[model samples]
Target chain A: MKGMTIIVKTISSWVKLLIFLFGIYIVLFGHLTPGGGFAGGVIIASSYVLLMLAFGREFVEKNLSLTASSRLDCVGALMFVAIALVGMFYGAASFFWNFIHQQYLADRATEFKLVSAGIIPLCNIAIGLKVGASLFLVIFALSVFCNDFRCKGSARELM
Target chain B: MSDIPLVLPAFVCIPLVAAFLLPILGSFGRKGRVVATALANLAALSLLAMSIASTNQFSVYNVGRWSIPLGINMVLDGFSALFLITVNLVSSAALLFSVRYMEQYTAKPKYLSLFMLMVAGMNGVVLTGDLFNLFVFLEVASIASYALVGFGCDDEQLEASFKYMVLGEVGSMFILLAIGLVYGATGMLNMAYISKAIQNNPTNVVLCFALALFIAGFGLKAALVPFHAWLPDAHSSAPAPISAMLSGILIKVLGVYALVRTIFSIFGISTTVGTLLVVLGVVNMVTGAFLAIGQGDLKRLLAYSSISQVGYIFLGIGLGGALLAAGASPVWASLAILGGLFHLLNHAVSKSLLFLTSGSVEMAAGTRQLDQLGGLAEKLPLTRASCAVASASIVGIPPFGGFWSKLILVIAAIGAGVYWAAALIVAVSVCTLIMYLKVHRYVFLGELSETRQQIKESRGSMAVAMICLACLCVFLGLVFLAPALRAELLEPAAKVLCDGVGYADKIMEFSKDMIVCAD
Candidate 1:
């Protein structure tokens, strides 16, 4: 299917990068702020969604590719699960222990440091990647199934 | 034995890890489907082994060294352990059955992945001590089932999936609202702490409201009479193995186990709650049995029968609770609960076996219509025999597992002076017999149909799985008969409920001395 109008394409193309950066910022500072893995992941997915809207499903499929994004999704989840599993054996902690902070929190002069929360931020980033990829894959899958019969309306109507 | 507690996290962890890894690994090699199926079944097998090994044990795992009343914890008490076994055993069999049966469907890797995720979620729901965590895991399992229901992608399957999803979401919303209200009242999300708080101030209006909401939510999940509209369509439309999994153990875990645990262990069963349960149970029993007898499709008939059997379990347990609350007789109360728990186990095994046989029959004859099939006793001998065994158990024929549970329920009802309940149990048993007789007369005992000229017996893993489960169904009857076995297995589970609010005291006792030092 063809994409939307030139004006819509032009604005989304420029705005997508800023949205991606904003999502990364939220994910990175998730341990400190309200927007964590899930919220940030949704934002990142929306940026890709903007790209798909501006350039059509074919463009996104050609660029990111379905299999690559799926692999990315799995990788992100595995990374998070690995982090959690590591906590089980690390130090004398239990499953999901924040061992990093337990050992290193005292070394910091103040509590407001970036790496202060041990595993929380790392966990957040892992979850953000996983959720973002999964959301994009879901939208991509849904889009592929919407053939001529379903998407009879014009791109202008969608706009 | 000391390291047994470490096994708790692995219950949820192993499945999640396998689910995620399968998608990636399934893309490799010429035998990726083989590899993925093997890994998925390995995960399920290990779960079954672990649950059996950990039976009758009580322990708690504090995640990330988070202490009780704060960080999330997984509890493996007798009650949860019982559910753990039920979930894993059925899952192991279902996964094995799927190994052969799922060949008809596309996207084998995705199906295996979703199956593992569903296992993980059910395990989590059964084990979690935190109420909110229970909700999360319930959604995990529910969503997987929804997607799995629509896996066929046909109009019928998609419609069933949509119906199930909408009704299920409504139940979930009610549960979440109740959890929120509970936290508002007790300022705690942990079930044990909440129970303690409820006991401390047992007269809170909000907690009472929350209890009412809990019954409604969990009852919907369990598919009691009023909330059972989605069960028939969802159970029949899904693939056969999924039908087995959903009917056999999913409803019990999500609905009855959760509801009973919440009511008995957390809120502490009272006369009002107990009566409500009995009413719902009777309605479900009467309605389900009647509806089942009229169904033409084999799968639809079995699905309705699942609802009816679940009623017996609810009826038995609710009878016990009512007796316990009235201070009339703890003897009959324990007996009633024992019957209920036994019925729950028996139904899980038998119903899953029945569904698997239906799947086998459907695969063999290319139809689940009772009239189109005949004389399967000679053609698909293992499947026919397994279906017969399951039917015998379900219909409460003597010397079978279902007989003992039904007898126990009837005896408990009579001994407790609930004559109407006793009468109702007998009446439902007759109805159950009639329905199964219909299934047998139409599907297995008639003259061989002209369309079944080339019917072949389902061999290999399908036959192996069916025969193994059929053996388990027969063997379960002896568990109730053997005094030692009954004392070891069913008693502990029933005792957990009989103790009621005493559950919180035990949990608090276990978590008392352990405190993780913070920096």
Candidate 2:
């Protein structure tokens, strides 16, 4: 698809990084704050979508690519499962045990600290990556289909 | 605190990891398909082994090592175990069959991934002790099945998938609304806590409203008569192994098992709900069988037969619930539930076998149209035999799995003094017999058609899967015939439902350790 107005394109190119950084902030502070993995992920995805909107689909595709995004999606999911499974290697071998909290950070695991929540931040990061890639891919696929729908529609008109 | 059964999470974890890993491995080009197939099969086989090896016991596993109020719990009671075995058995057979069967389709890895996701979701649905988690898992499974039904991307497949999605989403919405109502009423998401709340004030109007919504929602998912519009098209249009999974286990787990769990364990079956279930059951059996008799497509016929057979299970359980509520002897009540549980297992085995045989027939003959196919008995001897065996079992012939379950249902009906329901059961069985007879006459027994003269039976993996399931169909009755096996498998599953709201007490007793842990 074609790019938007030059002004919109220029503005989005600069603003996208801010959106991405803000999404990362939300994901990191998810355990303490209102917006968490899913919400942050959507925000990050919108940043990529903003670039696609400004620079055209092909421009974004050249950089991120569908296959890369798909791979990232799978990687993100496996990462989350891996994090959960890591707890199984520790004391008592429960599926998602917070061994770090109990073993090393016991007395110091205070509220309002960045390191207090052992795995929640990691889980949030994984979830953010997955949701962001998945959403971008979905939107990209729809944009590709929009071309086909137009052709099909025109064919119907001719008939 | 009790030792957490680490194995409880494996049921959900293995399939999930396999699902994501398959696509990555599948991207390995030429060898990807082989790797994906082997990995998927390994996951399924391990699931079956785990289900079988896991003892029939009650325990709860907490997620993230959090206590009950903070994190979800996975409960492995008799009810969940029974479903776990059925889901894993059918999934293993279907996965093995798909090794060869999926060669007809592109995106083989994607298909396998979706299959595993569906399995994982169903396992989670059965294992979860929390209501919201059930909804989430239900969505995961439902979404995967929706994509699977239309995997072929054929015009008809797409149409069926869209219709299924719409109806399914509506059903899900109803469930969400009901869950919201339930939370608003009881201020709890854990099923045991909700049950405890209900027990304390059983006559709350809001809770009653939530109960009605739950029935409507879960009833739609289960595809009871009024809500089964999307089933035939979706089940018939999917690839054969997928059809097998859908007909065999998905509906049983997503629809029937969830509904029964909600009513018996969470809400505690009242006379009204029991009667409603019985009425729905009667309607489902009659409508499904009658509709099935007119179908020309083989897979469509089996799909309808699924709805009809699921009805027998509902009737059995509902009769038991009604009897228990009326304060009857516990023997007759447990007997009715036993019949239902047995029928559920019987249908899962026989119906999947039937679908697989139909798949093999389609693979060899290149058509599922009953009129276009004929006389495969001599040419495809093994498939013909498997088909005949499954058909007979479904028709409730003397020795197969379905016969014993149907017989139990009849005895239970008579015992419960529901003479009309007993009569309806027999009449529906006759209708089912007529339907399968039509299949036999048109598809297998007649003179060989010229176009199918070159058709050969399905070879290798597909053949082995069919053979195994066909054998299981015949031998499954041993669960009932062998007293010890019955005591182990079916009896305890029945008792879970028979115990009703006592499930709350059991879960509470186990989770009583959460308070101690929190300190």
The DockQ scores of all candidates, in the order shown, are: 0.49, 0.47
Please give, for residues B130-202, the per-residue lDDT of candidate 2 as tens digits: 9999999999999999999999877799899999999999999999999999999889999988999999999
List per-model TM-scores for chain B.
Answer: 0.98, 0.98
lDDT of 1 by residue, A67-127 (tens): 7788889888988988889888888757887778877785777466677789889999999
lDDT of all the models against the reference? Answer: 0.90, 0.89
- Could you tell me which residue pairs clash in candidate 2? none
**Local lDDT at A58 for model 1:** 87
Model 1 lDDT per residue over B1-519, tens place? 458767999999999999989988876654987898999989999999999887788887788877878889899888888889999999999999999999888678889888989999999999999999999999999999999988887779989999999999999999999999999999999989999999899999999999989998999999998899999999999999999999999999999999998999889989988888888889989999999999999999999999999999999999999999988779999999999999999999999999999999999989898878778888887888899999999998888899999999999999999999999999998999999999988888879988777889868888888988999888899989998778668888999999998988888887774452233
Candidate 1 lDDT for residue B384: 80
Give me the candidate number with maximum DockQ.
Answer: 1
List runs of model 1 lying over 4 Å from the truth. A4-15, A148-159, B516-519
RMSD of each candidate?
Answer: 3.0, 2.9
What is the number of residue pairs that collide in model 2? Answer: 0
